[model samples]
Target: MRWLVNHKQRLIITVVFYFVVLLLISMRKNSMYKYSTETYTMYNISSSLVVSDPTGTFRAKLPVSHAFINSVYYYPTSKSLGENAIAFTMAIDHHSNNMGHHTFNVLGYNSTNMIKSVATAQTEGISRCQYTTMMARTNTLSRLEKIEIESNGVSVEVPFKLARYTAPKPVIICISPQFAAEQWQLFVMHVHAANRFGGHLHIYLTSIIESYFELMKEYERQGYITLDYWLRMKFANPRTPYFEPNQNVEWRNQAGAQTDCLLQYKEAAEYIAFFDMDDILFPRDFPTYLEEFNAVLHANPGKNYLFYGRREHEFVKASTLSEFSFTELVQSLRSSQTVKRGKVVVRPEAYNSTWIHNSKHVSFATSVQVSSPTLVHVQLPVDKNGKRNHSRDLWKIEFGPLIEKIREDDIKAIEEDIYR
Candidate 1:
């Protein structure tokens, strides 16, 4: 009894240590139980689809009938508070008539922790044969992470990174896929004129011949152009009836590609102009499109989109088709009796969706048509029959001899190619 009394303090300490260990074990077991259950349920219930980065940047593709996640944009709700939110653009197959309600599950994790969040997507615009543009929004204040989207028994995963909150420059130009790889000269002219106007150009190509691909890559390396390639599916039997025909798929894919470009550079560009390879927007009053755009914005600050009208021009019969300069060609052409539809320049902050030639789902209001002579459309001259009709009115406009910048080697190479 006396010995027991002497060691009483030590006995109490031993008992307390055992109790503490038991409590920690119980807590850890419970945590593991919950985690295992949740993870198991997620894995068992969800179907996993393949994810691909179309742009090798902020865009991802989901298998929702070959749907695409165009752009993932991140911005803080309040700069002072540091709370963040994410907005993304999505493009689905136009033939999908019954989208019903769509939602996205964002599973965010780096290397250690994972968090799952859900956001309901809202449809912004739908082009039946082209694409359907939708926007998904999450106001969850968290770090940007990977995205997982599940629809109709399929799920896709993609890495998500935050884009700049604002663009450093006022204007960036985005061009849809130019499948016609032989038109290298026209493409160069488009790039040169855009750069000359203090605008950056981003081109998305669906499929290009090997030579054009190499040329674009060289241009990309030179910091003059940002180019992205999309791999199209090839069928064993071209005549076989598929769920979505190639033509229909191409149309939607092109629209999605355009949206992807818009979303990719939305933060880095205040205004995005959607132009085709064979088209250019010539500003009559100002030295560059940037200046003209700024004037239009000043006049219509509340407007979210500016739509320009176009005048079509055809090639002259006198010029030899084999060897031609785009600049000389434009000067020789005259306007066609039939007017061509124009293109659009949209404020990224105010518009969430865009078409090939127009902006849709504007946040503010409808687009305003800028007056003529301010924004002129210079269409590429096409040779129809033996007579060419190019617009003579736009000849007075000076675009600073942009064709002179085209490399002689490039012209010769394109001319020599059989594809032309």
Candidate 2:
């Protein structure tokens, strides 16, 4: 009877142990499932929606009866007179032929004289639209006042403003339209860093959730950043024959966006830096990026491009937060080795075209390579059992105080749910 009791007790203990093990396995699977779902949702939320006028600051939409100016680019032929000559990308009526000709008038600023140019049409395969890219030059206008394009018995008048040329410091254009909610912290950090380094941010928005847009709008209102909406419909058609594969579409669009930004700000910005939201150009010795850039330019006079390699840092989840501090959270993360790829800061006068990583159509002979990195890239850290680690140590040397301030300011935004 005693032996029977012992055997029964052992069986009960074994059963309980197995039950606990199964429970743990089930919990782990559930955790992974939730993580994956969140990631998928984030991807869609970041890329799927389109908002044409978030702030209602854009001009009135053209009447449907008339062809619209889908995309307008102002590339100054002479840097001496900013935006005196301009380029236009116009979308004609659907029935219009690619060979159709039109005339555009540039109404001079505070003058009655009109600069007229004959526009030539071309077919853009990706957009599946017959558009016209016309270059118009006007010496009568000190600056662009307005553009009037007449087509198909309908005329559309669009206002134009030239970017200010008298900016005290050289400008650095940072254009990233596709940003996810998970990147809000990093985005704020990048802005602060850029401002500290004497850089102005020109951010383009392709798609973003309402909450993120609110935060961005606030930033724009403060003059800390400039926000522009990307009208995707104006650029590409879903059914175009040249439509890139789904994965490559975003990549291709990003390249095109970079090119547009380069042209848009070429005359306004003395130097343009093409960087991702996760990247920051840190100066080792100088306090701001402007100082470092000036120093480099002084060392290599008339250099068209300054290339700096990147040191990548991984984000690590903090084990504990003393008081919910982003600065503290960043300090606790881990970093990786320098990335093989690098980014460039180019003089607008030097490069006519650009890619995601490098510039093309180089007009000058001098390209300088800085021995140390002027930029540090902070990427999402490797996931270790669901914990996140960041690359805060790398920035601690030059940006410690700023990071702390960012954390303090961000905390307020977070509490108000302005930042996700």
Q: Give the winner by lDDT.
A: 1
Q: Candidate 2 — which residues are off by over 4 angstroms? A: 1-70, 73-83, 88-161, 166-169, 179-181, 235-252, 317-326, 363-365, 382-420
RMSD of 1: 20.5
Question: Could you give candidate 2's per-residue lDDT for residues 1-420 as a string of tens digits?
Answer: 011223322111111110000000011222322322211111122232222333323222111212324344443345632345554443232222223333444433345556654444332223332222222223334445566655443344555545344443476666755533345556666666566567877776655544456766888787778765544432121111111122223342454455556656767787888877777665666666767777888988777688877665555433322223445445544444445477778877665445566744453257787766535566664342675344534444221222211233433443333223
lDDT of 2 at 102: 36
How many steric clashes does model 1 contain?
10
Whole-model lDDT per candidate: 0.51, 0.48
Error of 1 at 222 (Å): 2.6
Against the correct fold, how does model 2 do in TM-score?
0.57
C-alpha RMSD values across all candidates: 20.5, 19.1
Give the Å shift of residue 225 in candidate 2: 1.5
Off by over 4 Å in 1: 1-83, 89-97, 110-116, 123-127, 130-133, 151-154, 164-169, 233-247, 250-252, 316-327, 363-365, 374-420
Error of 2 at 58 (Å): 37
Give the per-residue lDDT digits (tens) of candidate 1, residues 9-86.
211111111000000001122232232221111111123222222231322111224454545666544332125656
